[model samples]
Target: MNHASLDDFLKHGTATLAKGPVALIFVEDAVELDSTLRHHLQCGFKAVVALMPPAFELADDLEDTVHRVAFDCSHPQAVFDAVNRVIEAAPGVWLYYGYNAEYLFFPFCETRSIGEMLAFHTEERRDAMLTYVIDLYADDLENCPSAVSLERAHLDRAGYYALARPDPGNHNHPKERQLDFFGGLRWRFEEHIPAPSRRIDRIALFRAKPGLRLRSDHTFSDEEYNTYACPWHHNLTAAICSFRTAKALKANPGSTFDIDTFRWRKSVPFEWHSRQLLDLGLMEPGQWF
Candidate 1:
């Protein structure tokens, strides 16, 4: 069901949230909406909610499987409000949120469903999972003018780095277990990206509680939920292979002229498998086999 606002959807569209993990895909543009839905459905999310512009059209095939919500993605707070409301309505349920053209990958995701991975995560007493937003761009911009192509996607094999996340309210003591991740398109084309959005670290997967809030920075109101791992060992991690940034950079008329192409020497074709991200250290397998 389509809701005019996030409040309307939270009040009405979350009846099935408790059944299993839910993926809230916010669509900034029309590119790859069908593939995004198909990927999440395959990942075992009980409900896949698509929040897009009023003019956006979902594929005919997704009419029955995916839920549609009318939203203005330009307002970042809209996403946070929707997630917080859903979590409040169904505490302890797993939820994931991302933009269109972003695909999730976990270790052994080939043979295992996301449900199985979350089950393992729950056993370790973890509420949130760290996800790296690894940027993916088309190999030939001319052939794939939109800067997106599932078949010819490429990602950076190296150059990813991180620094301590600062706590501005606390005189830079630094937030525990949180860091600012940077790499890929954003790093290569830093001039075009806003400073606040450069970090690729996202607590994309989490078990929601009633009072929890997803902050504008993509971190949760509860500090522990922002951690990279548990106390004893590293918990499982996921990779969101995405073309969101590349798509934005190329679409912006101001930046388009400067960016001849997204490809660089470090770039390599994405293998479209969990093993590729694992070998690149983008995501962790943890204790799961």
Candidate 2:
């Protein structure tokens, strides 16, 4: 059911908050909304909460399973507010957040459920999961003008790189166990992308807790949660195959004429599996059987 605002939805819509491993999909646009919801559901999330504008209609196929909430996603704090409130309401629950065109893939995600992954994560004494926002674009944008087609999706196999993340308080020292990742469409079209928003590393999966806050840069207020890995070993890192950046670049008037093709020599067709992402070093799986 739809609520008037984020607050309204958090208060009324989430009657079954105790259900763990909820996927909050904040839809900035309606494109691929159905597929995004379907992917999360198939991954065995107990609930898939979709936050979208009031008028945007969810596909009929999703009405039975997906929870629809009415909220504007344009505001900077819109996603953060909803997530923080949900975390407050349901502490200790596994939570994940992403956009419409993004799909989450953990190690062996083809066979394992998100709940299983979180269970393993909890055993490792971790509260969050690091996710790489791997850009996926239509190989042939001519046929699919939206710049997103799963059948013809392509990604840069080798453009991925990382740099030391600066500490928020002091630029002199780098943040421990944290690195700013860059690549994919955002890196390829750096001229069009603002410098501040280039990093694609996000703590997309986490356990909800009191006083926890999701920052604008996709980091968390609690420093430990923002860490890339545990003390002894790297944690399982998920990949969000997304067409959001590609779609935005193609849609934007400023960049449309300049970008004749998103593909370069390094571009390769996405295998649409966790193994491909793992092989490319786009994501990591630590001590996960």
Cα lDDT tens digits, model 1, 1-289, are 6677667777776686757799999988889988998999998888998988889888788878888888887876877877777788878789899989999998988788889999999999999999999999999989988899999999999999999988988999888777789988888888899999898999999998878999888999988899998778877899999999988888899898887788889999999999999999999888888
Off by over 4 Å in 2: 168-171
Looking at candidate 1, what is the lDDT of residue 11? 76
TM-score attained by model 1: 0.95
Model 1 RMSD to the real structure?
Answer: 1.5
Q: All candidates' lDDT scores?
A: 0.88, 0.88
Which pairs of residues clash in candidate 2, taking residues 3 or more apart in a chain or in different chains?
A: none
Worst 10 contiguous positions by lDDT, candidate 1:
11-20
Give per-model TM-scores.
0.95, 0.96
